[model samples]
Target: MLENIREKSQGVTAKVILGLVILTFAFAGIGSYTNSVDTSVAQVNDMKITQSDFDKAYQNQRNRMAQQFGEMFDTLSADANYMANFRSSVLENLINEKLIDFATAELAIRVSDERIKQTIREMPEFQVDGKFDNNRYLALINQAGFYQTSDFRDYLRVEMTRRQLNQALIASEFSLPYEEAQLTGLQNQKRDIRFAQISAEQFKASVEVTEQDINDYYQNNQNRFQNQEKVKVNYIALSVDDIADKVEVTAADLEQYYQQNIAKYQQNEQKRFSHILIEIGDDEAAAKAQITDILTKANSGEDFAVLAEEFSADTFSGENGGDLEWIEPGVMDDAFDEAAFALSSVGSISDVVQTDFGFHIIKLTELKPEQIKDFAEVKDEIQQLVSTQKAEDKFFELQQEMARLSFEFPDSLEDAAGAVGGKVQTSDWLTRFGNTAPFDNAKVLDAAFSDIVVKERLNSDIIEVNDSLALVLRTNEYQAANTKPLAEVSEQIKTMLIAEKATEKAQNIAQELLTAFKAGEDVTAQLAAVNASFEVKNDIARFGAELDNNIAKEAFKLPHPVEGTLSASTVTMNNGDLALLEVSAVKEGEPATNSNFAQQHSQQLAQATYKSFIDALRDQAKITRREVVQSSEQF
Candidate 1:
């Protein structure tokens, strides 16, 4: 029952609020956000959201949608209006973040440094053997992109403050006794609904759009018919692979390279071992004492594996009988390496050893002697590596030379192409939106239309398309934005008008049928005329699992029927069809205040209360959005 609450809270707005108020992106640290120069895209009161900040958030959301939906995400991008809404939503999230921060400050919500430290210490990810391990904590945050622990602490402090503010607002909300009873009854109520759908398609055969109607509609919405600016260009696409293809390594060169990196061809002696590690935290004495006890047990033949499993701080190896299999001498700590290699006897236990990590008691299991592969065995692999290295070296040299030559010549890409051992290639007309890549690359597209390329007519400075590829382009043709002639788009306009008329007619017919049903008039003839019949559903809960989404949404908007009166309404379905619904019978489910549904709903109420608070903050704040953000909404 409560799962629906989770489902309801996963929308874009809820997710963004959750992300800003909490670190929901990862276990810790926000996504990588950085800027060299501050250029505000928006401002919430005194708080500014820079272009870098907006780009980071927008790109993060875009990437998340792409990941969640895969190819289906492209459908969202395909619609101009949908894309605009998506961009606006991301901007709104940034605004919400600043607004939330502002509210937190006004409320004087503060998280103490000691409390932040305690929170970090209590996190299970940073703990080893039920105790906080600073090394583990540092490694984890660093891996999560918080290179400095202080930065992670600051982030944690801010999130804690926002959470505190929101929580306080939520806790302040209270439903009175009568209000609670009313809400419980309403929430538990079920409805018996009968709906008749009038398909917009059925009326399309009779719909007509006169030429004059089409012409007038087209004249009024001409901006929608205008074309976007486009450009055709001459470009040199240079890639590391092209240079790699030209790199040649002789047999003698491969032989010399192999000898220089001979250690890579030689396999080091491997040791298999078991160990009991006791992590040294603030209480190093306790860790040392524990290791000593475990060491004594192992030497005394009291089940070494059992001792390791129970006492080891390295939980990963501890679970596997402390086995660290077939590791080279230098694979771990320098002290660990020395202790393991010094043991010559198989099945021999070593004394308690001290290292930077902690104390460890080692039991040598087995060893593999060193071996070297024949030159013939690795010749092919060595040749490929040598060739790649040479190609990379040459590519770097040529990349810089190409950039210099492109700028030096300024007007043409031929010199740059020649310098990089590449050829100038022509491109199909690229829209400002970039119909294809390398034109699709943001930097390439930006330069492709910048005044130097489109107006002054100079070769673009070398732009890296990706890690491997670089590009220099010169405009060959430019298409000025223009509106399509009415003659060309008349049919398209006519079809759209016909569809709109048909939908409106369908809605009117649905309303008439609804009126007839309410007046207790015979509607069998009307139903037959439109080829529609009532669909009855019983015991439909608030979850609306048994009903269509749009139909359910419309059905529930009706006020409860009382004194033998019926509740009726009409809604336009997603497909331009209309659903006329009437609730004939209502039954209330048994209310259990302690149920999961009730608890989840209480949380929902709390969120709703918090939302009101944020809304108030938003209304009171001075919000400003710059042009860079506005122009992006069009795409």
Candidate 2:
């Protein structure tokens, strides 16, 4: 069954799957390990899976579900049975990853350092303008919580090794010609079908929906017609941007701010240089001789750019005359930076300078000296900075005051707004599924309908609308959830009850027609008596979309009829209409000769084979689970 499903999932590589897993867990801080918590959740062979790992994985899964389901995610997250099943699935995936890691290590599967470096260089996150940027690469690693480049490289190496192992296993799978032929036939099989719909509308006139029936239905299903709880709120919002224009800064403040944030204003010195390199791979003496010969040519007044373009081994920069373009301090290797920066004048060349990459003959071409802008020159920029800082400070202070005043008053936002020198804003009637401006915010809606604010009529705690904006709201007008009066909903209930009865009648008529059709009796007269007509769709494939989907599905499920006979069944559609279906002829598909069919068949077989192999590996492994503590808190 697993193999059959895999057969349909073509072009899904193991690397793509692992990449998705990494992305899913990235939000849970999967790559960041905490040494403080050492409790084990599970052990695969000698490696122990930590409780922290399980917690992180589970939280990542929850975050994904929350993003997918939005408000409904809260309901599912609170369901104990759903949570139990979710935890089990998370732990199982973690264990499987561990098992794969252990098996790869046991088999000594390895990836080359060059492969790992290439992978990192090609990553879009670490690139700028389609070229690899060293600074961006370092920044991204740090942002992803990796303190060292080697740690990220090690993670990449593990992922690459796992992908290599999976590819090897999948490549070992093959399919027989007969199996491919059979699957091709099955994919193209066709059947000739005829169907007639007995619409609910046909029986609507006969359905008796009395006032008593309507009243009974409305009474029995009052809960379905009840209005959602609603509230109108008065809120005070504070934003940094709104307060920024009101702040003022003087000359002294500008000077003080400039001094405090000198690093942000200071520019780093830059240098432009070109070099001719001789890479020392195995024989250092040979490389030294080669660099000396190049240095002699350079000193003898030969063009440095010409020499670099011909003799430099740094291919990335060599093509551009070894132009390591304009580089700031700390951008290059330490030894290289120092040697190049030591040259004081343009056109000055260094003789046989040595670093990790090679021996280099360096020439300084241009320089830009570092400068700090004077307070008077940057006064406008300083004023903007000071104003933003002051506004943020004031916003925080006012936010705290608003929270305090709202809490003390309990029933109104008037005191809170007055304390902050802001105005109280009122919203329209807002339901759990609210509409309109402020009510559209999920946090605002959740707080508006919460028990403390809606039922007890108290001001909500400060709800953050964004990083710079927050609000405190209180319910001004509240409406309790209640069912509509029966009289108000009786007509709607009457229409619905009539539709239900009509559908029941249509289904019975369809079943009777189907029975008569199979019994070799003509049903044309019967259909005419009910004011129904037959519609025919011919040459429908097993997966064809020509006929109504429900009818097509039921027709294919019926066995092929004997010659000159028919197979009939009754099918119900989404609109409560009944379809009386008859299969007149069945045709087995011939194996397709198209290249697309060949490729699809090949992929399906490979996937099926890979799935079977993995299942076998899982079956052979000895697995165990310890008592897991499921917590509601996000890790």
Candidate 3:
């Protein structure tokens, strides 16, 4: 099962949906990570997943993971094995997409131009006050990493076609009563077990770590104990923090600012609504029947978003689960506006409303009333804004002046600092792999290490850290990269060797105990001789959280005991702890009869059906791979 692969991997359908979502958030300034060489990394039939495509997709996935993990991401990515798996999984997702392309093409699935245009129109991001805005659409596509609207349209065409194919497979899935019962039994299975932890920490104190072991380990792994290249620099810093305090805004200034930006203080009443549109096609009755079924589902407390995405003819809004975002009067068709605005409360649905286009079942998701802030109500905010603007203006002026001085006097930042009424400050040691403090930005590190600043012994140009801060730097001192002295790392090596030896000891003991238990020997007596006891857990469910995660996973993974004999095995843990697992009893749950169980079963089967089809396509596809460079970036 692909479930055994990337943790119940949602498969290529999920990958495409994720790509579509990230495309919306792909701001203009996000740096491109693709290579200049246009080579195929993977191919399906005549179609190729180019290096550029792979790089862009990988960057998107990497960004998602980084956002999810935050500070812990640095530690996870530092592991070469972990990163290698991550890169491979990302490439596999792309390869799966290529296979989908071939399958969809072979099946004659294609998204029409009208569908594409409608989808674009329904997109809430491209709309202003609920009406589709062409200018907003153009600006957003550029921000979403597309230089041309046609390019985005082409990309959307492929994915939407794939979505059509995916939807067909999902809609065709059904779980029979017997299938649901069978799955419920397995899902709710329980195990009664007793396990003894053969912890490595118990053996660590007894494990002998000799001087020779430390020396040998240290000699073989010197790369692990190297002092990375480092540098300290003298820099002239200019920031809004330095300038904003010196600026002042009077009470009259606040009033004038409030009056100048009065539009910003006014908020019009708006409501968020979603609609399922059924166009008046050739068979009007069939269209009405389809919409009636959808309306029934929506009224019965079914997820309106899911219903919208599945059935709405308005492709643009359907893509966002039928959401048109916030809208007031007159933005949409007169009929739609009248029906939607008449809803007095949130989560209320309007009756069928007819327009030239078709019929709509509108759901009022949210409503916000109008607001106006008087001068006194927002005086503090206005003061801060005025001060910030003044500081920004001053920051730009000083940045230009400092840049001119730094270039004219390349040898030192002292003159530049004097010009800006600031002093030259020294940085902590910054390494090639890890930077320190305010100099941690990539641009700052690049400028600090550039040939002009380091080798030529000249000041760097003004590097903008952000909108509020900029700096000019020159190298003060440099240290050559070298291995750390043996004296400094000897104890570290000794500790490592001890841990390794201790793990070995734990494994041996766990294995010996497993043999005794399986052979019906008196292992409990043997274990009691040592200061350890097996913890007993009775009737443990498959996903019970009370047990340790590592142990619980293994407990369910163990095969059932047979012929009145316990199933015994030695399990090695992630933390180098070993466990002697003995399962004494097993129970299969009674067949479930609940409606929720059947519904859950159907959803699971649907996803499985879709993934199985994709996997089959992938297996039959002529896929190829090429060696490409991997990024060596660190957080």
Q: What is the C-alpha lDDT of each candidate?
A: 0.79, 0.79, 0.81
Which candidate tops lDDT?
Answer: 3
* lDDT digits (tens) for residues 1-635 of candidate 3: 22143333447876888887688558532345344445777777777877677778877887898799986775576465887788788888988888888788789998876678678888999988877766577778899888877799898999899899888988887778888888888888888999887778877888898888888888889899988777889998899988999998788888888888998788767688999999988988988888888888889999999989988888878999899876656456789899999997999998888887898999999888878888788888888999999899999999999998887777788888999999999998887544444665657888888878888778888898878889999999988789999899988888888898999988888888888788878787767754567999998988866877777788888888899576878787767788888787889887776788877777898999988998888777787777644632322
Error of 3 at 110 (Å): 3.9
* Best by the TM-score measure: 2
lDDT of 1 by residue, 1-635 (tens): 23344356768988888877676436543543323445788888877888767777787788889799976776556565777788788988888888888878877888976578668867999887876666577779998779977789888998899888877877776555555566778778787888888889988889888889998999999999998888989988878888888999999989998888889788666678898899899998888888888787778789877887898887877898898755554346678878887888888988878987789989898877778888899999998899888988887788899888887677678888877778989899887562554565567778888887888788777887777788888899999899999999999998899899999998888888878877877787798789888888988887755677887776667877776565888888877788888887778766445455555666788989878877888889999987455333212
Compose the digit string of candidate 2's lDDT tens values, residues 299-382.
999888888888899776688887776554555567878888898888898867788777987888888787787777888888
How many residue pairs collide in each prediction?
0, 0, 1
| lDDT computed for candidate 2 | 0.79
State each model's C-alpha RMSD to the native: 14.1, 13.0, 14.4
Q: Which order, best to worst by TM-score? A: 2, 3, 1
TM-score between candidate 2 and the true structure: 0.68
Query: Which residue pairs does candidate 3 place in steric collision?
Result: 119-316
Lowest summed lDDT window (length 10), candidate 3: 1-10
